[model samples]
Target: MATTTTTRSFLQAVATEEVATPLRVVQMEGLVILKIIKHCKDHSPSLVTGQLLGLDVGSVLEVTNCFPFPMREDDEEIEADGANYQLEMMRCLREVNVDNNTVGWYQSTLLGSYQTVELIETFMNYQENIRRCVCIIYDPSRADQGVLALKALKLSDSFMELYRSNNFTGEKLREKNLSWVDIFEEIPIKVSNSALISAFMTELEPDTPVTQCDYDRLQLSTSSLMERNMEFLIECMDDLSLEQQKFQFHYRSLSRQQAQQQAWLQKRRAENMSRRAAGEEPLPEEDPANPIFKPLPEPSRLESFLITNQISNYCNQINGVAGQSFNRLYLMKALHEE
Candidate 1:
């Protein structure tokens, strides 16, 4: 009886702790960051994912280590093998005294295109097992422009609740006060290193004031990235327009149905009056068999919200890159004059 009571108390305490402390920040080890960068860069253009191992303490999710998921076909057998591979890798890491707790997963994105239905579905799948988890997105393509394009994102609580209900009607969205921007909440990432590792990095630093990386940062060739962003932005706009058309079509059909129902009701009431004048039983005003009286289904706005979010992200990226390019061009012009 004592042991059972202790176990129950412990479980209750854990549940209360989780509910009280929501994830606010992601603390990633410097070595883990480097490993993620290496894995993503090594598979540039071809997207890849890796599982993060870490400790979840208080409001901070600490990512200490990560291992890449092997590339495999989409077949069920291959996916089953992938699952076994992950189990084996985690077992080995545990044996080596590493932090093997699955905090979250990281994936490489192409040109900042990580917002999608598939990503949401993946988050839902992870949420089934983990109470709260984040996806660390590394954009290798954007990194080429001298930017560390790493983002840690999680689905917003309200959005997740709405998503789980599978109801994205305008009314439901309004009730939740959820917009496209609320879909993903980005948690700030803090990279940390142990004392020994920090000392080692300090010693390895070169004496030069300027390096190859600094030169690469000043490169003015951003036309390709800009063009690609514009192309994607246009595609998203088209998709958004399509979604709007669907809503418009739905509204039109609804209006027509309403009009038909009104006309039928009026006609039925007139017949009822004639039957009353003849001292006969009045007919019913509503027709349960009529399809026009049935309510029209509203179109889900989830797709439109996602497209809008993607468009906003693309615009912000383009603006940042353009601003940097302009600064570089002006600096080059001043240098040439000198």
Candidate 2:
């Protein structure tokens, strides 16, 4: 009875606590970062996801640990097994006195191709249980270019509200002041290490000024990355054009319906005038059963917005990689001349 009462009190405290604190930073442990990197790199080119465990502090999410989910087929029974596995893992961690609270999940992306409707749906699912959550995206392919290529992202508040309502019409989007770029907000990642680990890393530091990582930064091979980005960008542009065609078709149909309705109304008015002139009761000006009077549904703009966002992301990636590649080539040229 006492244990039950304590559990109830704890639940009440958590329920009453404010969950609207906007997350400003993601403080991740160095060990957790290494684990994520290893898990992602181990299955490169094949996407993988893992759950993050952490504590939610004021304006900061401290990610202390994480565990990878086993890859399984998409079946009902398999899904159930996956859920059971997650619960078992959490229970085991709790036994070991570890922070087992689910903060979010991390996933591997190929060349930064992580923006999609599926990702948005995943965010929505996580947000349902956790008041605030973030997806840590690691692009293993991009990391080859000497960049960490890891980022934390969450759906913007306005975007989430609009998504929940399932309304992405032009008027609603304008009212919310949400554009394609406003869909996802990226939070800065701060790596934290314990004193012992910090000291260990300091001892491991090399005496040489130039390291292999510096050599990687100067590598002038970015053609493949740029090619892939351009290909994806072109595909997105085609998709955007198709979405525009859908809106065009809808508008055309709407205009034709309006024209038909106007003609029918004029004909009814003329008939009513003749009946009145003949000293008879005129018919009603409006007919509820008329097919032309039915309102046409507007096409949803959500898909188009996402496609545009993806295109912008691809463009930015290409731009950054190309700029770096050019600088590297110039440095190489100067070194050869010297």
Candidate 3:
């Protein structure tokens, strides 16, 4: 009976197709945001991840609770160990009488370098299990720059279909009309604070003396972020160039081998025909131990695509930061003249 029930659940999961839902709006509780911010800040410089627990309504996923995962080896070999640890944590959460069901997961990213295969694979797994689950990316580095960068994202329907097919060929992409923009659907996040908490915060607001803040927004510290982004973008370009060279070399080698194989087959056929014409038994046909050529294995292009996407993201971020910095500089100049 247990096996039957398991089979039925599996069938139900497979049969349910995720429709193109309306734009998701994430309603995150104030406490949930605080916990995530604290978790990310505490684990700065190293990527941190946690699970979000909440209820999902038709258009909004209300996140109420979260807990950070235990630190684990980042190597792929210990993935199973991490999974087991998460399961144990989930069991404990169930005992605590809190919302333990995983509505989604959250990860900290530096300068938005979150578009990797691991993230996509994790999201796929989570969405497969819970269709409405979203991944929240917290940019701690950006947050330190006086902006709380929290974005809730989900793999778009077309992107999920393309990924599940595992066919990223040019033709397939064209058929699906997929692009980098289609990869992630960002949901607007609204922080919901209780009245009591709001009152408490308001009561504490007057504890500090009010003073005029001069040039707070005009700080040029954004230059450092812009520099780091440029450096990373350059490195990615170098890696992309190397990947392109590798693909070119592979294709050239493959073409040469194919040509040699064709020539060798033709020569053998000619020899066989000549021998038969001479009224002699054709030489026993057998493939040569060392064939004329062997094709090189095709290299995986997934990493190349991911790197390209990351570079694009960096460019977008740089543009935004630069624009804001320019506006600040203009304002500062105007204020000084005044």
Q: Candidate 3, which segments miss by more than 4 Å at Cα?
A: 1-23, 74-97, 161-177, 202-216, 265-297
lDDT of 2 at 270: 98
Give me the runs in candidate 1 sitting further than 4 Å from their true place: 1-18
Q: Considering TM-score, where higher is better, how would the candidates rank from best to worst?
A: 1, 2, 3
Which lDDT tens digits does candidate 2 get at residues 1-338? 99999999999889867456789999999988898999999998799999999999989999999999988578999999999999999999999988979999999998777888999999999999998799999998888788888899999998999999999888898898888889999999999999999999899999999988787787777788788888988988999999999999999999999899889999999999999999999999888898888888889998998888888888889889988988988888999999
- How far off is model 3, as Cα RMSD? 6.6
In candidate 3, how many clashes are counted? 0
Per-candidate TM-score against the hidden true structure: 0.93, 0.92, 0.77
RMSD of each: 3.3, 4.7, 6.6
On TM-score, the candidate that comes out on top is 1
Ranking by lDDT: 1, 2, 3
lDDT at 50, model 2: 96
* Model 2 ranges off by over 4 Å: 1-19
lDDT tens digits by residue: candidate 3, 174-242: 787877677888889988988999999888776545423323444667878888999989988998899
lDDT of each model, Cα atoms only?
Answer: 0.91, 0.91, 0.82
**Residue clash pairs of candidate 3:** none
Task: Say which prediction, candidate 2 or candidate 3, comes out ahead on lDDT.
Answer: 2
Angstrom error of the Cα, residue 139, model 2: value is 0.5
RMSD of 2: 4.7
- Error (Å) of candidate 1 at residue 306 is 0.4
